[model samples]
Target: MQATRMISGRAIPWGAKNIDTDIIIPAKWLKTVSRDGLGRGAFESVRAVPGNIFDVPANQGAPILLAGDNFGCGSSREHAAWAMLDMGLQAVIAPSFSDIFSGNAFKNGVLAVTLDEVHIARLMAVAADGAIITIDLENQVVTSDRQDRFAFAIDPFRKMCLMQGLDEIALTLAADDAISVHEARQAEDAPWLVPAQG
Candidate 1:
């Protein structure tokens, strides 16, 4: 996981509501466990149209995505975030998001920003021209060339983990000393439970 303090780049506008995981990676593409090669499947359905925003060259490698309300809704598929990351998206902005998708995204190092509908609309407008958008996760603020600025709230623990690039296992490992102490106590309480050394 990479630490995401601030990101600046053109935002790929995907202003559609209820974009479930299926639409993100498609069900057929889920066969592979590897996160690689999933970018080709990202928004496959929407890209059929030749003029789709994502198909446009300017949006390629864009780090931010400006989406509609209720983005990333429906089934919890971690693949959705994986595909987006493979496509080089670092963050997504929307009015709201599915709780499961948001959690998965955060764990995968994707910043899911939830703002009001009005702010999302403004962002969509800026993204129309593939304008560069800046997100400061630590500061909890987003800014764009249109002079748009908005503040968002995030759980402190989640923020810390993202900033420090710590996943669940990493977080637990961070308490190695405490875990060692507890295991020593357990060994004293039940010596038989521990396997005897040969």
Candidate 2:
């Protein structure tokens, strides 16, 4: 996962509510476990419609998405987060999000920001005008070039993990030295319990 201290860029501004995992990436795209090419499948149904927000040229490769309340509301597929990352969305701004989706987003390094409805509306308007919106995870605030500022809250542990680019694998590897020490001690204390060294 990549470190994400701040994200400043164009936002998709799709303020529709109740966007589920299947809407983000349909089940047909779920056959493969690999995240490669999943971006092409992200919002597959929405993109199929004429002049969808995801198809707008200016919104291409936007790092931030502006969504309405109850975003990512259905299913617990980790692929939803994978698809967003694949599409280069480092953060999502919404009034609220599904608990499962929020967890998945955090684990995959996608910042799921929760703000009040008023902030969402303003951001959507700003996005519609093509203004840049910025999210500062370190400072826990979202800002716009037009002097819009909104603060948000996040778990300190999740913030640290995202800022440090620490995934589960990285977290485990951080204790490598300690693990080695423990194994050595166990072997010494109980030779029969330890496997023979190659």
Candidate 3:
């Protein structure tokens, strides 16, 4: 996972509501355990349309996505987050999100910003114009070159994890020295609990 203090780029203005995990990355693409190449499968169904936003050249590789309410609403699949990262999206802004999806996204180092519908609509308009948008995690705000600024709230712990580029594994590894010391102490204090060597 990469440390992300700020993300600024043209956003994909797909504000469709109730977009589920299956829609983000169809089940057919979930057979593999690897997260790589999921980008080609991201929004697979939507991309099948004649002129979907995901297929638009201007929106290609945009680091931010502007979505409507209930984004990532269905299944508890973590693949949704994986697909988004594979597609090069660093953050998703919406009126609301599925709790499970939000947690999965956070764990995968993707930022999910929740704002009111009015703010989301404003961003949709800005995205339609292909204007650049900036999301500053440290400040907990999203801003546009047009002077549009929207403040958002995030869990302090999650914010810290993203800013520090600490995934669950990294977080656990950070306490390695403490864990080693604790184990050594236990070995000395509780010899009966320690397994005998072969």
Candidate 4:
């Protein structure tokens, strides 16, 4: 995972609600555990159409995605966030998001921003004209050209994880000293409680 403090780049507006994890990376692309090359399969079904948004050159390597309400719904697939990260997207803006997808994305250092519908529509309009946008996770704000700005909320723990690039394992390892101390105390209190042989 990479630290996600602030991401500034062109915005790709995808105004579609109920975009599930299946639509994000597709089930066919789930065989590989590696995150690499998963971007090629992102939004495959939608990009198959001529002149689709994701296929456009202006949106190539865009760091931010503006989507409709209820984005990242359906199955709790971690690959969905992995594909987005592989595609160089650092954040997703929507009116709302599925809880599971949001958690998965946050753990992977993808900023999932929930803004009001008014702000989302304005961002969509600006994105149509190919405007650059900035998402400041630390500041909890999204800004773009024409002075369009919106604020969002995020859990403190999740925000810290994104800022420090701490995944689940990294978080646990952070408490290694405390865990060791506890184990030592337990062994001292109960010598025979420890398993003798495997």
lDDT score, candidate 1: 0.87
Q: Candidate 1 lDDT, tens digit per residue, 79-114?
A: 899999988888998888999999999998899998
Residue-by-residue lDDT tens digits, candidate 3, 91-165: 999999999999999988899999899998898898889889999999999999889999999999889888988
TM-score of 3: 0.85
Using all chains and alpha carbons, the TM-scores for the candidates as numbered come to 0.84, 0.85, 0.85, 0.85
Residue by residue across 70-128, what tens digits does model 4's lDDT show?
89999998999989988888889999999999988888888899999888899999988
Supply candidate 3's per-residue lDDT for 44.
88
> Which stretch of 10 consecutive residues in model 2 shows the poorest summed lDDT?
189-198
Flag clash pairs in model 3. Answer: none
All models: lDDT? 0.87, 0.91, 0.90, 0.88
lDDT of 3: 0.90
106-172 per-residue lDDT for model 2 (tens digits): 9888999999999999999989899899999999999999899999999999999889987777788
Best of the two (2, 3) by lDDT:
2
lDDT of 3 at 159: 90
For each of the candidates, the C-alpha root-mean-square deviation to the true structure, in angstroms, is: 4.4, 5.0, 4.5, 3.9
